[model samples]
Target: MFTEARLYSPVTRTGDGDVTVHLSEEHPGVRDPEYRARRNAIAALALEYVPGAALPRIDYTEDEQRVWRTVSVELARKHRRYACTDILDAAARLALPTARIPQLDEVSAALAPLTGFRYVPAAGLVPLREFFGSFAERTFHSTQYIRHHSAPLYTPEPDAVHEIVGHATQLACPRFAAVYETAGAAVARLRTDAALKFLADVFWFSMEFGVVRERGEIRCYGAGLLSSYGEIEEFRGAELRPLDVRAMGTATYDITHYQPVLYCAESVTHLEDVVGEFFATIDDETPARMRARPVSPRPAAAARPRGSA
Candidate 1:
C-alpha cells in the first residue's frame, strides 16, 4: 500500500507538446491557475532536458524566492537544533544560498568539488530504478520547481526545496554520499521488482527519513525530515525504535502526514554499520531471504530524548 509513487504527483505531456502537472484536489496549488501554470512551465523544462546537457534553470519569481528565503532561514535555525553534525558540517561547507532559490546547475557546481554529485532535472516521479540507479553514477535527479508560494513550510510532494535543501546537503557529506552511491549500486544488482521495492523501502526509512543520536540528543539526517519545516520539529516525539534493516524495509508508513513512528540509530556509527552494510551487500534474493525469516518484535521505545518524551 505504501509505494513510493504515492509521494509524487503525475506529470503528463499533451499531443500538442505541452506539459501538464496533474495536481490532486488537496494540493494547495490545485485551484490557483497561476500556480498550475508555474508547475507546468517548470515541468516542461525537465521534460525537454537532454542527457549530459546543462541542467535547466528557472528564473524563480520574486514570490518564489521569498518562499525559499523564508523556509531556508527557518529551516536553518531548526537545523542547528535538530540536524546531526555530519549534515551541519557539510551544510556549512556547501553553504547553499539562503536569500534566493539556487538553480540546479549552481547546486551541482557547489557539490562538484565536495562530493562529485550533480543534479539532473526531474518532471515528477522518476521511475524507482532510474532514480536510485543514477546515484551510482554520482548523479541525482532533482526537481527545480519551488513549492506553492502560499505555503512556505508545506508541500504535498518533493519540490526544489526538499531536493536541494534536504538531499543536496546530505550528498555533500562524504559518508552520506558514499551510502547513496552504494544504495545505487544495490539497485543495479537487483533484478526483480520485489527486490527493488524492498531496496526503496529501506531507502525511504534510512536515507529519506532516518534519525541518529548525537550529543545525547536525537538528531535528524534524513532528507525528508531535514528539508521539512514541521516534520523536523516533530520527529523526536515519534515512537523511536532501534535501527533494523528488515524492520525498516518491511514497515508501511503514510506519506500525507507527520510520521507517527521513526527508527533511530544509536549513533552515526551504528547507522553506518546497519544501514550502510545492508546497502553494500544487498542482492535480488536478499529481500525474500530476510523477509522469510520470522519478523522480530518491535524493539521498545528508545530512552526518552533529552528535551521531550
Candidate 2:
C-alpha cells in the first residue's frame, strides 16, 4: 500500500520476516560503513520486540550519543520559547537524560507512572491500525534507531528523537494521554476506512501539529513542532485556525514540507475538551458527514502524513 506513512518511514517487513530500514541516498550515513552497520544492528534489535518479550536494547555509539545530546540541547532551547506549558511540564517530570540515548524500557518506565503509556520497539512503519489502536492500551510503538550522524539536526524520517523527545514527552501528560486513549477508542468503533482516515487527519492536525493560544502568544504542544529544531521556530509563520474538527478532518496541506496550516486550541484544557468530545462521539457516519460538507478553501491534499514523526 502506497500510503502517507511510507512517505516518511522505511518499510519494515518482507514476506520471509527479515526487515531493514535504509537511509536515504542523500544521508551522509548512506556512504559511511560504520553508520550503516549501526542502523542495521538497531533494526535487527527492533524486530525482536514483536510479542511477549522485553523491548530490545541498543548500546549507542559515542557518535549516536553525540547526536542525541546535540538535539537534546538545541531542541530544549526551542521548546522553552515555543512549547506549551503542559508539554514543558511533562518533559520536566520525565527528566529524560540529555547525555545518552535512553533505552525503550527506560522510557516506558518513566512514562507509565505518569500516563500509563509505555514504549515498544518498532522495526519501521507500524501499521496505522496498530499504531493508533495501541493508544487505547497506552502503548507507543517507537523506533530505536538514531538518525544518520551527518545530519544530526535533520532527517526526513522519524528517529528516536521524534519518538521520545517529541511524542513521548507529550504522551506523558495525563490530559494529552487521555485524548490519545479516546482516539483509540473511537478507532475501535469505526468500521469504515473513510472513518479511520478522517480520524488520522484529525489526529495529525491536532496531536502532531496543533498549537494553543496562551497569554496572547501562540504556543506549540504538538510533537512535530516540539521535536524539529528547524520547523519549531517557523511554525508561528503558519496560518493558524481555531480548532475546528470538521475542517481538521477535511483540511488540505502538504506533508513533505513544514505544515503551512495549523489548528489552534484556545488553551490546553480547551484542547482536551474539543478533541476529547469528538473522539467520544465520532462514529462511522462522522467521516461521511464531514466529507459531504465543503471545507473552507485551501490548497488540494487528500492525505495528511505525520511527517518524520
Candidate 3:
C-alpha cells in the first residue's frame, strides 16, 4: 500500500510504440500542458531504446535546470547533517553537477570506474522483478524526467532527482553496490509472490528508508531519506528500533507521509552485515518461516506515540 505513492506510476505504451505518462490529478505537473508533453517526449525515448546503445540525452530546459539546482543545494546541506559517512563519502566521489541534471549516460560513466554499475532508462514504473533483478548485472533503471518546477523540493514519484541524486550517489560505493547485487540475486531465486514481496519490504526498510547510529547520532543511509529535504530533517525523530529482519519485513508504513516507525543499525558495518546476510540466505520459504514467529516486543521508548511536532 505504501508503494502506491512511492513506487507505482501510470505509464502505458501503445502498439504503435507511442508512450503516454499519466500523471495523477494531484501531481504538480498534471495541470501543465507543457510539462505533460515533456513527460511524454521523455517517455518515448525509453520506449524506443535499444540495449547497449547510447542513452538518450534529455535537453532539460532552464526551468528544469533551476529545479535541479534548488533541490541539489538544499539536499547537500541536509545530507551533511543527516547522512551517514558511507553515503557522504560516495557522494563526494561521484561529484554530480549541481547546476544541471546529469544524463543517465553521464551517471553511468561516472560510476563505471568506481563500482562497475551503470544506468538504464525507465519510462515509468519498472516491474518489481525486472527492476530488482537488474542489480545483478550492475545496471539501474532510472527515469529521465525532472519533477515539475513548481515544486522543486517535492515530488510524488521517483524522478531523475530521486534516481540520480539519491541512488546514483550511493551506487558510487562498492559496498552498497555489492549489497544491491546480492539482493538482485536473491530476487532471482525467490519463487512465491509472498517471498518476493517480503524481500521488497525488507529492502524498503533498509536501502530505501533505513537509518544507523554513528558517533552517538542516528544517521540516514537510505536513499529516500537522503534525497528528501523535508524527510531528512525529520527522520531522526521517528520511532527507531534495532535492525530485525522479521520486524522490517512485517512493518506497515505509509509513503504519502513521513514514516512513523524506522529500523536502525548499530553502524554502517552492522547494516551491511545484517542486510547482506538476509539477501544472501533468503529463499521462498524464508518469509513464511519468519512470519510464523512473533516479532520481539517493541522497546518502551520506541512504543511512544509518533507524530509531527
Candidate 4:
C-alpha cells in the first residue's frame, strides 16, 4: 500500500535499453513492451515542453483512442450518477469529445476563459514544489500517456483520462476553480516541506477524494472519484466523516486500493467556505501550530490516518 507522502514511483531505464514506468501491481500493461515504449516516449515529449509556451502535441494511436473512448463513455455514466451537480454542470461546459483524445493544448485552450488555468506537459515526477506551485500561475503539469489498453477502466497511475476528464471537469467549474486557485496561492507562501505536504494531504482528501451532502444525498466532487470507473461507485461505501482539517492533515492513506475513508462537506458552500478558507491562509507556521495542538479531535467515522498504531 502506498501513501501520498511523495511523488508516484519514478520512471527508470534498464541496461537492456528498455524503460520501466513504476506502477502498482494492478497495472495491466506493466509487462507489455509496446506500452512501455509509448509511455516513455510521451514522457520525453513532456520534458521538452517549455513552460508558458504552447504545449506539445500527442498523436494518439487507434488503440489509444479506443482506450480513451471506452473509459470516457463508462466514466460518463458513473459521473452522472455519482458526480456532484456543479461538476456535472462543468462537464456540460467542457463538452469534451468522447470519440477522440484531445491534446493537452486543446484542453488548455478550452479552460483558459473558464478558470485561467492551462494544461502543460509532465514527463514523470514533477518535483512536488514545481507541480503544485505552478497552480499559482494557473498551470497544471499533466501526464500524456493513456493507460494500458488492456484495462480501459482502470489505471495504476493518473493517466490522460484521469487528468482531463476528472480534473478538467472540475476545474471548469467556477466554484471548484476558486478552490484550486487559492491552493496555488497558498503554495506560493509556503516554503517548508512540512507545510507544503500538509497542504497536499488536505487537497488529497478534499479535492481528490472529498464528498459532499446535497439534497439529502452524499455525492462526489473530487477528481479521484469522478474519473475512476470502479472506485467512484465504491466511495459512497467508504467511511464518511465530516470535514476536519486536523484529521485530514495527519491522515495516512493507501493510494493503491479503494480509499477506505473520506471526508464530507455539509454542502457545496460548506466545502468552499471551510476548505477554501483554510487554503487561502496556509503558511509555514500553520503546520507546526496544528501539530502543537493539545487535544485534536478525532474523525468520527474513519480510522486514524495510515501508519497510526
lDDT of each: 0.88, 0.83, 0.86, 0.81
Model 4: per-residue Cα lDDT over 2-116, one tens digit each: 2443334477656774555666554577678788778887876776567667778888999999998988898899888888899988999888999999998889889988888
The residue-level lDDT of candidate 4 at 166 comes to 86
Cα deviation in Å at residue 302, candidate 2?
A: 17
Give the range of the ten consecutive residues with the poorest summed lDDT in model 2: 300-309
Candidate 3 TM-score to native: 0.94
Alpha-carbon deviation at 300 in model 3, angstroms: 12
lDDT value, candidate 1, whole model:
0.88
- Measured by lDDT, the strongest candidate is 1
lDDT tens readout by residue for model 1, 50-80: 9988788898899999999999999999999
> Over the full model, what C-alpha lDDT does candidate 3 score relative to the true structure?
0.86
Residue 149 Cα positional deviation in candidate 2, in Å, after optimal superposition: 1.4
TM, every model: 0.95, 0.92, 0.94, 0.91
Alpha-carbon runs more than 4 Å astray in model 2: 12-18, 298-309
Q: Which should have the higher TM-score, number 1 or number 3?
A: 1
Winner on TM-score (3 vs 4): 3
Error of 3 at 225 (Å): 0.5
lDDT tens digits, residues 1-309, model 3?
A: 336334646888888877789898878899999999999999999877899898999999999999999999999998999888999999999999998899999999999999999999998888788888999899999999988988888888888888998899889989888989999999889888788888888988899888999999999988888788778888888888889998888877667677778899998788789998999999999988998997667543332322211
Task: Tally clashes: model 2.
Answer: 0
lDDT of 1 at 6: 74
